[model samples]
Target: MLPFERIITIDRESKVPIYRQIAIAFINAISQGIIKANTHLPSTRDLSKLLEVHRKTIVAAYDELEAQDWVVSVPRKYVAVSAKIPNLKPKKWMDEVNESAYRALFQLPFKQIVVPKVKSNAQLPEVIIDDGFPDVRLSPIDDLLKIYRSYTSKKHSIRNATFGSAQGSLKLREVLASYLSETRGLNIEKEHLLITHGAQMSIYLAAQLLLAKGDVVVVGKPNYSKATQVFEQTGATVVEVGVDKSGLLVEEIQAICQQKAIKAIYVIPHHHYPTTVTMSIERRIALLKLSQQYAFAIIEDDYDYDYHYASSPYLPLASSPHQGNIIYIGSFSKLLDPSIRIGFMVAPFNFIEQGVALRKLIDVGVDGYMQNALAELIRMGELKRHIKKAKKCYFSRRDYLDHLLQEHLKSQVSYSLPSGGMAIWIVLKKEGLVEYLVQHPQLAIRRSAIELNAFRFGFASMNETELEQAVLLLKKIIEGFELQGVKGQL
Candidate 1:
């Protein structure tokens, strides 16, 4: 006889009735072949005694088993297992076949997107200094959360589950129209604005809408790689323009315009990537005038316009008197945190309408409640106040990092303190210096070789202690190279 006690343990506290537990256990045992077909089950009275339950509980368990065809009544006043049982086998082979067939037939040709590899947030190095990234520690998360919850709780507001406008929450657009006019000198209405996941999305939308195969898209030589990838995906030929201390050489771009029918120009005029050199006022004016003369679009990616440490930064080109044919995009990712995917595009209403149709096809719509909460943050001046406080903290950090670099790395590399953005570009006196540092496991910072001699360092995310450690590591590496006398020519 099979021992019932060892096979099944009863949980007196379980919400499932005691009898149901017994029945389920027996059924599972039969299906698993632990209890074979045609086996005799103990009598109800005996089971009652064995299980320490009332005889009625045992009778209920037996009745359940009989109903499920696991056991049946016998003429000898005994219960016997049903002759037939469910066939139980692992479906591994079947699953593998289905997956293989799907993979062969259902895969899309994926285009490679150029994305910068950032250190994982889950496990960061003890000391991390990189191109400027926002410190989420300083984000007004609690206030944003409170605002989100408030909007969600209001039953009348469509901030709950309803699909929002593809152009973005109208409330957010209204707030941004006023906000951008005051802050960046851009006079635009809500209708001209299209909210995006980030500036990248805005760039992609503009590329798909404005560009054609073999069309020319101009970019700086060491430009934002991701934007380059976006333009390439739209089948546009990317023409590289030279960038100097002032910014993109407008003359070079003008030369290209004369040679080819330039469809658009992608620029990060405020703090150019990897170099952090602000575009000179003259170049800004020239680029604007050229855009008019050539009849090409201007895709201005103003990613980090908020963290200016020196005198008030120059107003964006979109705010300039010559603002036609411009698709101005800005991101809240830098202001709040990168994870908050909120960016806005300022363009003509027709362009926005086209972007909305494309956005719906891709993303359907963004989070309406979150956008509304951000709007409230702007309306109440919480975001503005936070930016002011954060700018001061970042200014101090930037100056400290600059001092550390001068003290430790002055002999080995050349750099200029950036006027506005989060990073400093350092031209190394030696080649392969960065590749050597990358091999070590302890340090992680954004390093990119500029020309054959320089690399960029983004310092906005690091604190004083981390900055100190990073500078010390850099100093040690250069010393190690000197001690070994391992100098390589570029």
Candidate 2:
């Protein structure tokens, strides 16, 4: 006989009734093959004695077993494990599937994206330097969330509960149309903007719609890496133009265009990524003229338009004439937080309509509730107030980081004080210095990045304390590294 007492340990503290516990135990026993088919169960009175429970409880357990078909009863004469129950075969719980299943057997239909190799650390570093991003600590998220909750509950807003148009929320677009006009000097209407998940999506849509196989798209040699990936996905030939202190060498782009008819150019006119070098007005005008001359589209990713400290930032290329050739991309995510995916593309009406149709193919729509909520935030002037506050905070952080770099790593590095943007483009004085710094245990630098003996120390994400901590760690690590032999440390 099975060790019935040992198999069915009772806990009085458990919320489950004593009788139900007995029933469940019997069922488990049968399933596990401990209680085989046609085995006679102990009598209720005997089980009651064994379990130290009342006979009524044992009787209830037997009744439950009988009702569930786990046991058969013979009119109070006998209660036995059901002969009708199938033979139980327990599985090998420790067994796993074959190892070959880890890798795909067949070819993927599309080009697989390359995943970057990350350094494996037992714990996350205390100091993380991001590639340029807005500080979330200062974002007006509480106010935005309150608006979101209100929109979700209010009956008047219920009609917009479902997925909105592919173009995006009408209210948000209208608000942006007015907002962009005022802030960035963009001459756009609701019809010209296509709200997307973020600036990357806008970049992708522009790249996909404007480019085709064998077409050429001119970009800087050290351009925004993600934008490069997007353009490459379209099977378009990417021509590399050189960027200088003035910005993209439009002369190089003209040289490329002379050889081949290009489709578009992805330019970051204000605070170019990694380097944070703003384009000169002369280059901006020259590029616009070249666009008219070559009939190529200009993807002006003016994401850091609002982050100026020196003077009022230059108006975007889209704000200039020849609007037909430029697709302007901007982001609210950069202004608030990276996680808040809200960005827009400004293009001609016909082009936007095509993008909308293409967008609908792969997407149902964006979050209508979030869009409306943001629109409310903008309409209330809360977003502008927040930007105004954040800009001042960021300006202070920028200067603080600048001072920290000058104080700590001035001997080992050289950099230009950026008039705007969240990061300073620090160029290392020694060879292999950037690569060695990347290996330091206490640091994780954002890598959109790390080319041309330079990297961006994204100051906006960290406060003065964090900036000080990061800079101090950086100084300590570099000092430990022997530079150019003679006991100079890596």
The candidate that achieves the highest lDDT relative to the unseen native structure: 2
lDDT of 2 by residue, 392-425 (tens): 9999999999899989888998889999988888
Candidate 2's TM-score reads 0.79
- RMSD list, candidates in order: 7.7, 6.8
Poorly placed runs, candidate 1 (over 4 Å): 1-124, 158-163, 450-453, 486-490
TM-score of each: 0.76, 0.79
Inter-residue clash pairs, candidate 1: 130-458, 131-458
Model 1 sits at a Cα RMSD from the real structure of 7.7
Go through the candidates in order and give the clash count of each.
2, 5
Q: Residue 379 of model 1: what lDDT?
A: 99
